[model samples]
Target: MTKQYSLKHIRNFSIIAHIDHGKSTIADRLLELTKTVAERDMQEQLLDDMDLERERGITIKAHPVTMAYEAKDGQTYQINFIDTPGHVDFSYEVSRSLSACEGALLVVDAAQGVQAQTLANVHLAIDRDLEIVPVLNKIDLPAADPESVRQQIEEVVGIDASGAIACSAKTGVGIADILERIVTNMPPPKEPEDDLLRALIFDSHYDNYQGVMVYVRVMSGEVRKGSLIKMMATNKNYEVQEVGIFTPSEKPTDSLKPGEVGYLIANIKNTQDIKIGDTVTSQKNPAPLPLPGFKHISPVVFAGIYPVDSSDFEALRDALAKLQLNDSALHIEQESSMALGFGYRCGFLGLLHLEIVFERLQREFDLDIISTAPSVVYKCLINDGQVVDIDSPAHYPDPSTIESIEEPWVVCHVMIPSEFLGTIMNLCMDKRGSLEKTDTLSMDRLLLTYKLPLNEIITDFNDKLKSMTRGYGSFDYEFDNYRESDIIKLEIKVNDEPVDAFSCLVHRSKAEAKGRSICAKLKEVIPRQLFKIPIQAAIGGKIIGRETINALSKNVTAKCYGGDISRKRKLWEKQKKGKKRMKEIGKVSIPQNAFMEVLKTD
Candidate 1:
């Protein structure tokens, strides 16, 4: 059994940084230095347990582990740290992890220095009142300039980096100093146990053999096996079957005490029965109120997910239920499409978040699925002062509501080389974005702030920015507010029949061009039928763009070679009547591939 460390000797912290900033590498070195895992079991990115994370070279979830490190004072201390994702989409994961800690190690790349996401994460830490320790990583690279980066962090991030540790996480240089600083400079959890039980649920996952396992940090209580617990927000009670801490792997423990981060298992058959950010308390001696500062993060982007095969719908729903247990930000509801049949309309934080969930549904659940074009939540104000928020095009309210529609907007921060400033600004302007502020961080680097409609950024804007700046640009965004905009639904019609799956919301200024582009794409993919198929893009009752697929024909007059011209005319009339009748009642057979054609549209 592992020895138990007192609350005063335990330090809980998290590692936060920008994408590709060596955050995971620093985590690897820390695991090695603390001997958390045996030498034979130690590997690169040990905490990244998912195969997708290894393949993408990114951290998707926040991983927590307990490490026992003997300090120079000849005493062993329990260091509980969470390795968080650096991507902008997973900022919610970082925030939830930070709430369980008293401090965070703010790692900035020595070469790339501070980027957009670095500042965003630092603000999250500051909001939680966490002590931020600046650690300059990747100093072994040839372009490394630790001194300049320290100054950059101070000037740009406005953090005191005078005591920043300059280390190469790749070469294990100065790693020992980092650990020492964490133990000395960072403070331990100060929440005292007053015979009241309150454990904050940080994260969770589903297990088939056991049940729903919840990841939590004890703030001021102790929970052990056989302890009856109650979720304050949910008011659900369960008998604790087990309580343990993750030593890189689950290690069964006698009990979880205050200031320790651990997991608990009970009779939670359904993932929805437990709520994240809920306070867990002793059922017999429950707390009077839940913990403060629990904010429910809402999804900004919405899309429809349908199984490729109709039979896997139930499996898809079950897979999403399990995923929801792990991810609280993902919202799903039952929805159906005229072209795609039954599916789920899921809301995600961003495009990347939508994509990651889509990928996981396929990989983890072993299910084949297709998702529709993503849309942003639009608030519709009725003429009578009633408000309705719509995410799917099918759910859009009647246009004659006699009021304005409001679209969600975001404040986007972009950090890039000064040479690419003009191109970036022009690109943003093309996407209906307005420049708010431009600050020059250094002679080469510039930071530009832009306010843009959330719908504009959901497309290929990130790809365009990377291509234009040659991958040197860093981007981050936060929700601002809803503003009134002239937004309309762009519906696609095949043979005068509206395909609900192909419908989406578009801005008035770009509706005609967008409608034209989608019609052109559909014309290229949809197979030609015996009758003429007129593909049209429309807004309400007006058609904006059209494409025609000519009917395939075999000349009926060809069989009357050298016959009378009257007979040939008679045969042509018959063929024309048949074609007209076919066009009147023919059903447009839209294949599954036709549904994806709109999804891939730029």
Candidate 2:
């Protein structure tokens, strides 16, 4: 706002909940009640800007907006709230959003009660010392049970929910109460001891005309136009070209003071110069110490991304660089393969994260790409006492020289109706998961805890869980300690040539079957050649499965019908010799279709 609000007048908070549990709807109601957006301009999912997020009905990125709400106490309050993603893979986004806020609104569905993600988000908010206000949504539904939900919230989440506000965001019932509570109940920003200009870069994006737009939360001091500031992480100094705040959209401001969230345009030429979580300070009088940054985001799943045409390699590289500007969780580096040629090995938080990134590359950047089989990060201890972390099977070390391999695992919590417990148990057991604990949240809703390898769930584990439960299952997981596991690398070879893109690591018990299935899929896709092609799956020197693609017949004996039998035999023998020479000297070419089909094999 143009008016400089004192520290006590400012309230910074965030909205946290499970996916598809009325987070966006509540956000719409807040915006409407506060008059942040006009009644005519108001629409659903006001913060979800990306089309992909709208189509998928989920928030992929955290969105922040500044509002000026006039409360019942006859005081104008400046409220900054971040709407965070609810999916487990985007928990990092939630963390970033929470760091910028002093409190949070924990929304829960009355019918669904306490789900897995609800508990996980509660823990995240608690760890950050955020003041949480539990709100019950969808009370207008016929099955709404607010009393039982409140009890579950208190007993299951260990939080006092006696004053939980019961409201339906869809119908605008009790929306005023939610806003009033945010202003009166949430704590104000802490007092800044000094005014040396220390602002944290919570999020950032690139603009073609303005370069990089750095989002900031001013902890102390003021940042105005033409003020020289230094990025604490990079130690680079730049003059602030402009400063502003987001009114659900960018609005230029004369200055941003303490306890305010806004953006800065510093004439930055490129996106790579700025890093999320870096502290901003005035170059003339910098802060005594920098703020604590966020923890490193380690990707759980990895896959290879290559352009369909070789000439588009440079475009692919540029596209990835641009993509990394907004998505800090995405990891990409140059990795070349003999079969797939030049590409990058990208890492993601989970399977959904991987899918979204791939889809964005195709849709946003208009680039055609081939994604290889996804794999998990493995820690291999060598015989010489060195540990190597590898995400791609091409990086796997020699089997004899490795002392042990440790695979990452997660503790998963699934909330479903009691009727689906048996089938859920069978599915987890099939994925090499072990049951750890089980509890009954309500009369019919049950929570099951299982320890499963991260590799198991990166595939179709979530899909199967939803299918078995008839779409009533809600899943969430957190990283556990790494442990040694019996895993082996399965490599695929066509015509005796190893293909790095098709290789994957599998457990020893399932290696043969995995290899066999891969071989079968490759056999159906690869085109026939003049010489017979052998598709083999192997571990080291031992071949476990093989499929042969028959060669095309030449029909060279068509004119030799009346000739001597010896002449026909001679022609056939000559042809056989030619085929052997071609098979020995010729190289096999793998098409893009073959790569897609084989890499997607389950």
Candidate 3:
């Protein structure tokens, strides 16, 4: 069913910025100004619908909404606004969101200027060929200096940022100016003949009632209700049951056309059916050019996720599957442990993504989870020409494997005030991070780059860095391949038994410090289940340090008022039963908190 529609009245764009740069707040103001969402209906960061995102005040996923605004020239245009996640962990999602836009609103905090993630996202936007409209956000703040921010943008990004709009998304100052620039500076959607129906799936989520709802940007034709569409990537076809537009509020529309962004409801049931960047075209006459798709995002960090109640494994799986539908970047698999029962091995882009997923799993689904310390994938070679990926501690090759092992390295960029440079540098060096270069971004700010092992960064490196800089520093890293290094495996043993799950790899020079810290933290967290538990970090059977949890004592004091002699005997029997129920205090194994102890680097 093909429908004809008028063209050239639509503009699609996305907002990109580092975390806490007022991206979501700016989007809210835009929605309010366009009258897409009512003034009274506005909530802080309305697009951040996830409970975890709301609580954390960070956008974890990209959300799309359509708004209509009449320009000062009396021309009305429909603007499809996409709000993207600012964290580096969601960089792939951000990139996909940008693909649907012709331009992006690059928001930078006037006071914070361009941080590490800001530079990373700006380069991504440039790579996608999206026109950038720089906006100096938070200008109303006392620390804001729009001129200095503009100079930083020009110097770092090489853009003529002289006329960048200075706006306070919180106060609505210069907001209209920002919107006007979006309309005038952003090019209208490209007009292509409706020869064949072609739409690009930038994002999708699963709905229990509607099945899979796909968010797509139509590139070359009309997609209407009951049309048969094929996902080019998977060669899967589905009949569109519904076509609609999102106002941040869903509204059913008869059809969607070229350059318009909207959603399609089909019988598609699985996320694998509609992958991000897959092209949807008419099964009868598909488009000739395949849509340009980015590489599949690979998770660089891995962690163990266990349900608080071992019986909740099924519930956890269901929750994770549902989350994965919207977040294609999240990966999970099932595994069993003698201690933790059934749990999952989850893959995440980085530490931030890992944290967000766990938070959402608990907050949204009400599934309490115990997440183990995060680890990065390591590549190792054995003496017999064998190579293996060590994602979990259990998979780590034995120390006697007799061949070299390489850990992933990253190029990290840290931006901090000049005063804390010495402290921050010392911390990085202690973590086996080598300073590669340092440059002054401003008279009082410095940008330092370090080549650090990915394993080190995956642990408490982030927390330590923030603490060292007094929370005034921002950092981002990208994998810079692997490097050969002198690495030592630190094994944790309990009761003379090696626990592979509690093992970690560290630089030989820092093994003693790292081991002692890990053991101490473990002692504080791992409770005495039934018996006292010994936490010892060892290298080649030689213990570096050890901590022991005292065995828990059980006390039973019950009344026996019955006059019957047999009743008194029964009471004594009941006391014995109670003692038996007290999980054999000396042999109870590990506690739930032990899994979380190693998560904190500091």
Index of the highest-TM-score prediction: 1
lDDT of 1 by residue, 75-108 (tens): 8999998777777776766777889899999988
For residues 42-101, could you state the per-residue lDDT of candidate 2 as single tens digits? 888999989998888888877789999999999999999877778888777677678788
On a 0 to 1 TM-score scale, where does candidate 1 land against the true structure?
0.94
| CA lDDT scores, all candidates in order | 0.88, 0.88, 0.82
Error of 3 at 347 (Å): 1.2
lDDT of 2: 0.88
Taking all chains together, the TM-score of candidate 3 against the true structure is: 0.87
- Pairwise lDDT winner, candidates 1 and 3: 1
Better of 1 and 3 by TM-score: 1
* Per-model TM values vs. the true structure: 0.94, 0.92, 0.87
Model 2 CA deviation exceeding 4 Å by range: 528-532, 550-588
Clashes of each: 0, 0, 8
Error of 3 at 453 (Å): 1.8
User: How well does candidate 3 score on lDDT at residue 57?
Assistant: 74
Q: Which of 1 and 2 is ahead in TM-score? A: 1
